[model samples]
Target: MASDAGVPDPETQSLDADELAFSDEGIEATLSPADPESDIAAIFDALFLISRLAQHNFPARIDIHTFAYLACLMSIYSGQPANEWGYSFSAVPPTLPYSPTLDGAIDRLVETDYLKTSKSTDVTNLAEFELTPEGERELGFFSTLSLLSRRLQFLDASTSAAVFTSSAAVVNSLANEPQLAAATHLNSSRQLLTESSTARLYDEFEALSQAIGKTDVNLILPASMYVSYLQSVMRATAEEATGEAVENA
Candidate 1:
């Protein structure tokens, strides 16, 4: 039950889709793109899409300090390209805003196995960090979680309040409007921050609403849709908890 359409390797790395479908019984449903055309199928499809995007966009690993400072660099160099990433970090030239010093981060990365030390004899600060094979694998997983945390921060910046949809039924209804659903994720994403400084695990989520409207829209929107499913489940659970409290009172 797998599609050969651009699947990444299946090794010690099983960083597959994290969006899961639950039936009325709270059991995860097996998904198929070929099932009957209901909201259920659409929801599963969206989950699958987001998971793929997360896996694909996942980046190399770095410690908490560098992660905290990465937002500045990402926005600063959104469209820019660098032939050498290690030098790129060194070039940021950390300042007194209490930023994670890129130079320091590069050194830590070298000490840890995350980055390999390949000397650049010609240039002064041009250290080469070919992310270790282990780093490559960890990067794939941790990058996804990092991406979501950054998205949450971006969303917080734009909105003073949390947008909580209050029902699973609402989520089911929105699943069909994929574009609109993805739009809900725009506040967060693109910067790749995380809560835990030592975060190295992927969130069991695949879709990202944060990057849904862009040209890479096709790949990310489906993943973004999973947010809808999560929102609905959360809303319903909260409502039930409230109702139970009232009954107890």
Candidate 2:
């Protein structure tokens, strides 16, 4: 079945299995950067690769659309804006259509064993998911791609807003919690993520230990959380520190 754009719409082609006209040789499609339909394929090559790796390694049924959706969620989960994910029903940044997209994407992933979902009955009606061992294994295969894709996709001014808005909201919510702020400020003013003046290094264990300081309850935070908080706080502190240093000078 030929689509309006002259491509065989997969849906239509699937409907009439007997009339399917494409063979491996006939299935030559390319990403056209100029075409709206193809723009996504071009931009999301890396994200698609992440999902593709999972599908290849595990039994994940990751279609292009499913991959894009999961990558979008991961972007959000990783602190990038929805725009960087480049997904919107109406075509705009952070403009999500509804929960169906997320639900379906998660369902597809979970059913295929590419992801695992668990409920925190320790809390009231609370549930969250983490990547399964299979998911993590697949992620490791494309770890660099996943990392780079998340960063590259949000390499725009909009990322600052997406990150900052949530950052500020979180900081304020914990405003009364001075221990965290104290740890935050101390960690930030030192800029500990990097090594000293001449060395390059990171201490994952120390960072993760600090992050899990309050694990009596049911919760977990990624080690990256501390780095993000420290970095953001340091950015603000740097502005003030520079102004003060200049005044002193």
Candidate 3:
């Protein structure tokens, strides 16, 4: 039941007859293993957190190119070669051409304000880039472990009915698209699903949950969709509440 990391494997755990697990003390066991995609996202989040936590350790400037190239830097920092990380540049979109250098990608990142050249550094010819303050703050949102865990617990709670409604919304939206709903072949469905980010995310999460031994599709799909719904609701509520509080001042 234990993984090489010595942690109990989520897939090996038994659920209660009622469809969820709880400790004898009535505490819920909500641990879940992130899928490969989620794991990569978490890695980026953690890297951003680590960089900010030890801001002084980083040079006044850092470098970033494309996502794949940046991922290579992250791998190197983790004492790995880029090839060992198994990154695919084509994963982004239209197939990327092989370039001996990443100068083009680096230029784009610099123009986008995600990375900025260091003002204090005196190296004239060398182009160094660093995470702009805005970039750090954006990545930092995903870096909050407490928030992520809290959201996971909410998804696994018995009272989580919101996710079902969210999943239904996804299904309803897809059904309303006559072109997609009428597709008889798998390729058509795949293309339509891939075109919509929401549809794609739900599909991926549902697959992950099922692969990890979730027997009830009804439960898993809803839970997967609910996470996205909760994020939107939480963000909107926070903005509204903060605005009202400011107006009343």
* TM-score per candidate: 0.24, 0.27, 0.24
What C-alpha lDDT values do all the predictions have? 0.29, 0.33, 0.33
Report the backbone clash tally of model 3.
Answer: 1
| Ranked candidates (lDDT, high to low) | 3, 2, 1
Candidate 1 residue lDDT tens string, 69-107? 222222112211111111212111121112123344445
Whole-structure CA lDDT of model 3: 0.33
Candidate maximizing TM-score: 2
TM-score of 3: 0.24
lDDT by residue for model 2 (1-249), tens:
112343222222221212222112110122222444333322333233334333323212222222333233223333233333322311111111122233344555557676653443454113344566776665555435432333333222222222333423322322212222443444432211111210111132233334455322211133124335545655676698899999999
Off by over 4 Å in 2: 1-85, 89-100, 120-126, 144-249
Error of 1 at 86 (Å): 20
**Best of the two (1, 2) by TM-score:** 2
Model 1 residue 198 lDDT score: 11
